[model samples]
Each structure stands twice: as structure tokens, then as C-alpha cells.
Target: MNATVAIIGRPNVGKSTLFNRLVGKRLALVDDTPGVTRDRRPGDARLGDLRFTIVDTAGLEDADKATLAGRMRKQTEEAIQDADVVLFVIDARAGVTPLDAHFAEVARKIARPVILLANKAEGRAGEPGIYEAYSLGLGEPVPISAEHGEGLSDLYDALREEFEKLEAAEGPSEEAETDIVIDPDADGEEDDEPAGTVDRPLRVAIAGRPNAGKSTLINKLLGEERLLTGPEAGITRDSISVDWVWRERHVKLFDTAGMRRKARVQEKLEKLSVADALRAIKFAEVVVVTLDANIPFEKQDLQIIDLVQREGRALVIAFNKWDTIEDRTEVWTEIKYQAERYLNQVRGVAMVPISATTGQGLDKLMEAVFDAYKMWNARVSTARLNKWLEGVVAHHPPPAVAGRRIKLRYLTQAKTRPPHFIVFCSRPEQLPEAYLRYLVNGVRETFKLPGTPIRLSFRKGENPYANKAKKKR
Candidate 1:
């Protein structure tokens, strides 16, 4: 097994900054506030030629065993136990505090190969803290400015030395290796369509209003209380991402804080949480908008769905807490009718009835999520698109504007993943929005693409002699 390194430190000491530096992605939320991270997140990290798993853990603190801080501390302790090496970081600008010393003692008791990292040590100003770290009983401190990407060579050397010693002590074992190849053109045709692959992990985000059972549904999918949940609204603050395998297919699930209406969101913390949820939706390929079945399709819920569609993300509507509702048939009919009438931009979005509390209809929900993802990344042959365009134009032609009939020439798919199309025609600006919507709906229905945003752009076809004629004139 590859060596795993865990980062542990007191709050606001730049552990998350260093974690993001090493992981090469901002997977963890970083802010000035203390205790931003409450759960452990792992990523594959690379330094020079070395590759291993690196875990970013919550900050350690002194609190009652029953409190939330205590639970975070337990998570950090668990990460330490599972790690082959530990990075105990300290804030060089603030110098060592009592909390640092307390955590240093805890790290010593754990007896793991600990590397002392004096973060925020960009210049000579951090000298005092570097000197103070020598008294913590850990060896020479590796001073680094993770945000500035400095002193990583020394950090790499320290990690390599420890990893080598461990490997030498354990010796070698026989293990089978499998090679994974990624082909860029695997998802589309070679002629006109862009090539891609679905082998990547599905990125799904669960979002809705506060206390809409978003976290509850994710917990049910994980089959564990990986997330903290209760009757309390807005229990989730940071957008926590968890990796799981469903039926041997890789899936990355993001549980975000519930979104509230802009005017209703007053607290600074809740605003940050809502912004984090928005960021999650922007990054996600498929977003499952969870709603309380008892009060489905509220104004806020409609607004959330509108935002998702505006972002051009594949969407799935999950009616959470379905078990609590009494009249299933009537509710389902109303939901279908409302979705058809209201969400006409992307018609036929998948709507699944689920109970996050009782684990009902989760299978259908995931199946719909995968289906939406597939359709979102779907590609159509140019020949097929042109044929469909021909038929649609024949059925209902483009309207005339100012005594001139707009000529519809040709259509070609420019991209996928919320499929975008380019149409070459005359007087493109004369086309009405309703006419464009007609073409988009035709493409969606003809190609079996549903629940995914469709984009169409019109361009006037180029004339070879136009430039020459302009020059002569």
C-alpha cells in the first residue's frame, strides 16, 4: 500500500492551505474562520516523482467529548491512527500557543513519524516560531509558505526519507498491477464530434432549501452517518465531498448546505455556506435538487431549479421525505404537470420520489442521476442532426422579418456536456427566440436528450467572394 500522510494542527494555522497545495486542488474549504473543516478528506498527492495518498483533517481542539468540536477532534485522531506519517503544522506568524503545545503532546503520544511544518514562514519574520518549534520535541521544522508554493522541495525530502525507511523495513510483497488508459475520443465519433469518456467518477451535488433532507439522502446512500444530521436546519456549512463506489462504478457525492432565499439569508456564516453550495453546483456535472414532499415546489425551490438550469447543469428532482406524504398519486401528478408547465426550457427532467429517512427509492434516484449525466454529455452525428434539422424546418419553417424570409441553411453540434449546437444560416439575427426554442426542443426530442440544457447559436454562412468584393469596393 502507498504511504498515507495526514495533516493535523490547531485551528486557523493554515493546515487547509497546505493541504490544497499538496493535493493540487482546492477540495477543502479555506477561510479565515477557525474550524472550517469538520470532516477528513483524502486525495492523491504528487511531489516530484513520489505519489501517495494525503489526508486533510479537522483541526484538533480541547472540548467536551459530547460536543461538536469533540467529534471533529475524534475525526482528526482517527486520521492520525490511519496515517503512515503525520504533518503537525503551526502558525509561524502567531508563534506557538498553548493549543499548539497540547496538540504537539497528542502527536508525540501517537508516535507516528511526524514532520513539523512551520507554515506562513515566508521570510525571516517567522524565525522566532521556527526556533520555538525545536522545543516541541519534533525534529527540525520545515518552514514553508503553502499559499506561495515555497519550500516544497524540503517537504518532499522529509516525506521521501520517512517513506523510504518504512518501505525498507517492511520489504517488498507480490501484488498484481493493472494499467488504466484514458482515450479522449472514447465518448464521441472521430469525424465531427469531440471525443470524451464516461470512465471518470460521476460528480453529483445534492442541493435544496434548509432542512430539505439533502444530507439525509447522502447519508442514506453512503449507508452510514458520515454526515452530521438532525432536525436542525443548516446543519451542514462547508460543502463536504465524499467518495463512494456504487455497484462498482465510482461516484463522488457532494453534500451542501441548504440554500435560502437571498433576502432571508442574514447571517454571515449562512451566506458563506450558501455561496459554497453554489460553487458546488457550478462544479458538479449532475445536480439533484432535493425538496420536501410535504411542501414541494416552493418559490425557493423553483428559484433553485432555475439557477441549476441557467448554469447548464444536468438536473434531477428528488422529492425527499416521500414516505411522509399521504396522497402519492395526486402529488406525483401535480409534480409532473408543474414540471412540464414551468420547466419548459429543459423538458422532461427526471423526477424521483424518495425518502431519505427510510432509504426508499434511492436506487431510482441514482439511476436517474446517471442517466442525466449520460444525456448531458451526449453527442449526435452531424448527418443525423442535419437530417433532423431538415425535417423540423420542413414541418415548421422560420418566420419572415421585415418582408425578408430568413434562410435556414445547416446545423452542426459544436460540443456536448449540456450540448451546444451551431447553425449556419442567413440573417441569423432575425430568428425569433420562440423559433430557437422550437429548434432546441426538436433537437432534445429527436435525439432522446432530456434533463440536460441545450445551447444553440446562429452564424451567417461565409461567402468566398465577399472579402474580395469588399477589397475591390
Candidate 2:
């Protein structure tokens, strides 16, 4: 409703490039790589006399490579349905491939008007492809070079015409609305905890893997043997969401049975434990993932972080039994490096090195949960966020791909729970995944968003808004 346009197409067809172009800067990476974009990237864009929001989608490769069109395909279709207008981009260089034709069929199914684009038509070599693009049955394809910045004037004209029709047909009452809500944190606290809904106090889930002191730490944090404490693995079979208050911050700690791999969960109790812990993760607003200092980085740990990110919840990481580790210096360095490398998406992710038994750094651990919770509700103003991004890019330049320089254009927040941003750039495909990681880490450290996922996406701009606003006058 607030000026959104969706760019939908098959892989590597310069949709992202067109995104950057309309945005009037390189906010995305333009590369020859296909299926590089895995998520839909939304950006504020302007084209000639037209200014609106645009969304660039992941190439439809996963659909082809998929074993089945299950949940993911359904989600993708929903996302497409949510869009305003669909800019159907096709590769003018390759002409209309079978994939492109398939995409056109899908586009036709949507309620939105389709704007066909024959991108990568800079050279004389692409003229034949431009002609062939018309056969896809979405009306005439506007030829434009996403890479070389050619035929953009014609793109502006086409877009202007389409928007004019849209304006004429739409109700005049449709207007953008803005509100300033100052307090989302007040809503973070559980209603039942404060309201006394249950006489048995609160139910909190303190979950993690084997021997990360879920029992020992909960015991230490609670100062009791509420749950059995032992070095033996898989002792806590059922998830016990217990009640406690830390400095008057009421908590219902769920001491869960240690979760092992699904195949390794041979025992019925262990399976029950895993299931309970998973349910706890879903129910609880804030989930703390514990890690052993000795072996911190693991595939399961990363998966846990991803789950938290997807759940739109708050999270904290506690390095339990940190007091037992002798080589503290090396461990901290390794842990920091691994977190930055593996969990870059979790911006400002809270990392606390705590010893449950010794009670060392327990206060810091508690502090982190409060902080991460606050950050989960954190909203950065457009002015401050862009300012912060400007400083970050100025400090560390973007990485170059091949001979071409990667350009990061204007940046803005798309949405937030765990703060998400869209970076308009040239050659969004050309931008390396690692560079996106760099920006994520930078956002985490700079914005003080630790222990939360900060999604940073590169959007390629093409049809680069040919400054035809002057001519429109």
C-alpha cells in the first residue's frame, strides 16, 4: 500500500540490477552468477518521474532444484501475491528461456499488472533477443541494459505510462500513513508473568545442548537442585519450564533434556526432550543457546541460531563452564572469530562467557538477556541508520568482484524484529556473500544489535532512473 513494486523473474535476469538503477545507485551486486539471491530484497526506488518502493526476488532456481514444491514454493508465491506491481525481468542476452516462459505464466496468474523487461540489451548482439522477448505473451518487452546503463530513457517512459494508468484507475482515498510509536519494549514482558494468570508462577525454558549446564546453570541461577545435576548426558528427559526471578525480572526457566541429533535420539525420553525443547523455543520470546568453551562452533549451534532468526524472536548465547577453560585468551579469540564467521546474520548477538557453578559472569549473562531483549524491539530511525551506514562504508570499502568495483548505494531499514536492511547497489550478483557478512557484522557492532539477526541484502539497480524527472516537467 505504501508504494511497493515487485520485480519477479527467473535467475540472473538483471532484476536486481534494475532495482539499483531505479533506486539511482548501486544498492545490489550484479554478477553473472545465477540463484545467488536467496531472499526477497526490498528497496526505496525512483525511476525518471516515478518514485516508489521495489522488491527483488531470488531467482526461481530452488523451484527447479527442489525435490518437491512443498512449503518453500508456497511461501514464495505468497510473497509474490503481497506485491503491488510485478516487474517481470527476462535476460535479453539469452532471449526468453523455458524458465522465463514458466515465470511469465506465474506472473499472469497474479492480480498485478506485469511490466515486461528485456534486460542486458546494451549491445547490437541483444537486438534479436529483444525481439524474441515479445513472444512470452506479456505485451512488448522494454529493452534496457542493466549492466551497461543503456535504454533507460525508454524504461522511464514505459514505467511512467504504466503508473499513469494505475493512478487513473485507483481510488483517490488511498494515501500513505505514518505513526510514531515510542514504546515497543513495554510489550516485550509476558502478560501472564505480571498479571498472575497462573498460581504456579511462570514457565520459562532454559534450553541448550548436552552438558552446557542447563541443569547446573539453572541450579546455580536458581540456587537449588530443582532439576537433577550430573555430568552424565541426557539426564533431563522432559522439558521443565520452571519459575524464578532474576533481580525482580520474573522468569520461568525450562530446564530441558539435552537434545542430540534426531538419529542419535534412540531413547523415547530423549526424543520427548528434543520435542519439548523445540516447543520451548517456539513458545518463549527469549531463548538462550548455551555453548561449551572447549568446542564452541558446531553445525547444530548455527542451525539453532538460524531457527531463532526465522522465529522472529529474541536470543542470547551463553558460553557455559567458561571458568573451567584454562586457555581463556585463545578460547575468546576463537569464539569471537567463529561467531563473526558463522553467525554474522545474528547482529549484535549477545555472547556471555559464564560459569554456572562458579557463578562467574552470571550478572553479565543476565544483563545480556535484558539487552538482547531490548534490541529485539529496537527500531533505528532512517536518519540515524543511514548515518551509521555511511560511516561504516567510509571506514571499510566494499570488495571488488573480478575487475568491476562493487558499489553500495543508499541503505535503509526494510523491517525489524531482529533489524533487517536493504542495501541498494550496482551488480548485486557481483557482491560476494562474504561482503554481505561484513556489513552484517559491521551493523551488529556499530548499532549495538548483538545477539539478534541483522539481515543485509544487496540489490542490483538497473533502468537507473535516467534523470527524466526534469523532462517530465
Candidate 3:
């Protein structure tokens, strides 16, 4: 097993910057604002030859047990308990404050080792603070600058020492295995895997407006309070991903921050959060849009759904807080009507009513998710597509324009995973928008493709004899 290390500190001491440096990616949201991180985010980290699991946690704070700050502190405490080693960080420019000293005492009680980090110690400006950090009495402070990437070699030495002692006491562990294979004989070329055949985990992202219970739903799926959720809107600020095994199938679930309307999002931190959520949507194969049953299909909710459809990802609508609704039958009927009326582009999308707090309809939600994924990766044969096109053209021929009829000669599927098709036809520019819509709807209905975007493009057929004219002599 990989050694687990946790980075702990008070607010705005550059703990997240160290995490980004170690992981080699900007997976966590970083800003000048205090308390931006509220959940524990894990990533595989590599420093020189040492490899381990690193977890970034929320900043430590003191507050009432019922307040939000208290809940955040609780999450940090959990990380501290589970870690094999802890890195206690402090701002060298500002020196050690009362909060740091208090937390230092807390770190001392940990049965494991703790490395003191005096961050932002780049030049002479940080020397005084770095000297003052020795009073905390954890150990010799490792002076480093997380932003400029300085003094990491010293940090690596400290970590290597601790890891060596740990290995000596515990003995050699079984090395973790991986499934990727590297080829030594191949030239530089891209090897693309076919859809639905790669042995990778299925990626699913949950998104919606503020106060829509997105985190609650993900926590329920994990069967633990892995994510922080409460009677609060926008408690989650970062797009955190967790891996799990659902019914013997590997799945990766991403819990994103709640997106608010553009006008209401005035703060820089909220803007960053919204952008992070958008990135999660682009990376996912299937998106589950959570909705509050009491306020189903609000203006913002419809906008979110439209964005997902435009992105060409498979979609499933989940109506959360189902237990609080009084008239279930009436509400469900209205929901179906609204979905059909507004979401006519991708018809027959799956809608599942669930209560995240009570675990109602959880099984049906997973089944719908799997069903949508199957449809998203579906492929149609070339012969079947041409035959289907023939029947469609015979029933309703293209309308004549300028005394000439548009003739569609052939049809073929270019790709799957949001299936895209190409049509070779005469007068491609004259084909009306209504006619294209008819063909798209026909493909969706004929091939049992629903709730996924279908892309169809027209191209004029090439003249086969044009290149042969030069050889006529």
C-alpha cells in the first residue's frame, strides 16, 4: 500500500499550492481568499523517486460545533487521523500566529510523525519568520516556497527519512499492480481505443444549481459521509472525484460545485468554482442533473440541462427530495410534460425520482445511468444505416427547390459516443432545416437511440471520373 500523507494548516498558508506542486496538476481550486477548500481531495503524488497518496484538506479553524467552520474542522481532523504522516505548514512571512501554535499542540498528540513546513521562505524577507517557527517545537522547520518551487529537495529528504524508518519497522510491502502495457517497438503514433471496449472506469459527473442536493446525493452513493453536506447552499467549492466499485464494476464519480446564475455570481471565488464545474462536465461521459422536486425545472435548471445537451454527453434527470412532495402523481405528470416540451431535441430521456436523504429510488437511478451509457456508445452498421435511409426517403422525399429535388445517395455512421452520421447527397446546401430534423428524429426512433445528441452532416458526392480524364490520351 502507498503511504498516505496529509497537508494540514490554518487558512491561506499555501497548503494547496504544495499539493498542486506534488500532484503536477491544478486539480484543487486555489485563490487568495481564506477557507476556499472544505473537503478532502486525494491525488497520486510523485517527488523524485518517492511515490505516495497525498490528501489536501480544509484549513483548521475554531468555531461552534453547529457552524459551517466547525464542520470543516471536523473533516480536517478525519484526514489527520487516517494519514500515516502529516505536513504542518505555516506562513513564514507572517510568522506563527496563535492559531498555528494551538494547532501545533494538536499535531503533537498525533502518534505519527509531523514535518514542519515554513512556506514562502524564498528570500531574506521570510528569514525572521522561519526563525520564529522553531518555537513551536515540532521539529526543525523545512524552509520552502511552494509557489516558486524552491527547496523541494530538502522537503524530499525529510519525507524520504520518515518513509525509510517506516519501511524498516513494517517490512517490505507488496507493490501495487497496474494494467497499462508499454510497447517498445512502435513508432510515434496515436492508438485510439474503441468505445465501450476499454477496461477503464466509467466516469459520471453530478451537476445542478445551488441548494440542489448534489453533494448529498453523492454522499449517499458512497454510503459514507465522504463529502461534506449540510443545510447549506454552495458548501462544496471544488470538483472532487472519488473512485468506487459498484456491483463489481469500477466507477469514478465527480461531485462538482453548484452553479448559480451569471448575474448573481459576482465574487471571483464563485466564478472560479463555476469554471471548475464546467471542466468536470466536459470530462464526464454521463451527467446526472439533480433537481429539487418542489421546484422542478426552474429557469436555471433548464439552462443547465440545455448546456449538457449541447456538450453532447449522455444525460439523466434525477428529481431529488422526492419524499417532501405531497402530490407525487400530479408532480410527475407535469414533469414528464415539461421534459417532452422543452427537451424535444433529445427525446425519451430517463427521469428518476429520488430522495438523497432517505435513499429512495437509488437502485433505479443507477440502472438508468447504465442504460444511458449503453445508448451513448451504441454503433450502427453501414448497411443497416443505408437501408434505413432508403425507407425514410421513400416515405417523405425531400421538397423541390428551384425546380430541382435534393437526392440523398448514401448514409453512414462516422462515430459513436454521441453518434455522428454523414450523408452524401446532391444539392446539400438546398436541404431545408426541417428536412434535417426529420432525418435526425428518424435515426433516433429507428435505432432506439434516445437522450443523447445525434450529429448529422451533409456532403456533396465526389465525381469519380474527374481524376481519370488526364489518362484519356
Candidate 1 lDDT over 191-212, as tens digits, reads 2432122345678999999999
Winning model by lDDT: 3
Residue range 1-473, candidate 3, lDDT tens digits: 46899999999999899999999999889999999999999998989988899999999998886898999998898898889899999999999999999999999999889999999999999999899999999989999999999999999999999988888888766543553446532553322332232256678999999889999998898898888888899999999998877777667889999998889999999999999999999989889999999998888998899889889988999999999999999999999999889888878889999999999998899888888988888889999999998998899989999999889999999987789999999989999999999999999999999787889999999879878986885
lDDT of predicted model 1: 0.87
Give the count of colliding residue pairs in each prediction.
0, 43, 0
Candidate 1 worst ten-residue window by lDDT: 190-199
lDDT of each: 0.87, 0.70, 0.90
Query: Which scores higher on TM-score, 1 or 3?
Result: 3
- The candidate 3 region of ten consecutive residues with least summed lDDT is 189-198
Root mean square deviation (Cα) for candidate 2? 22.2
Clashing pairs in 1: none
Q: Residue 140 in candidate 1 has what lDDT?
A: 92
Q: Per-prediction TM-score, please?
A: 0.83, 0.48, 0.94
Clashing residue pairs found in predicted model 3 = none
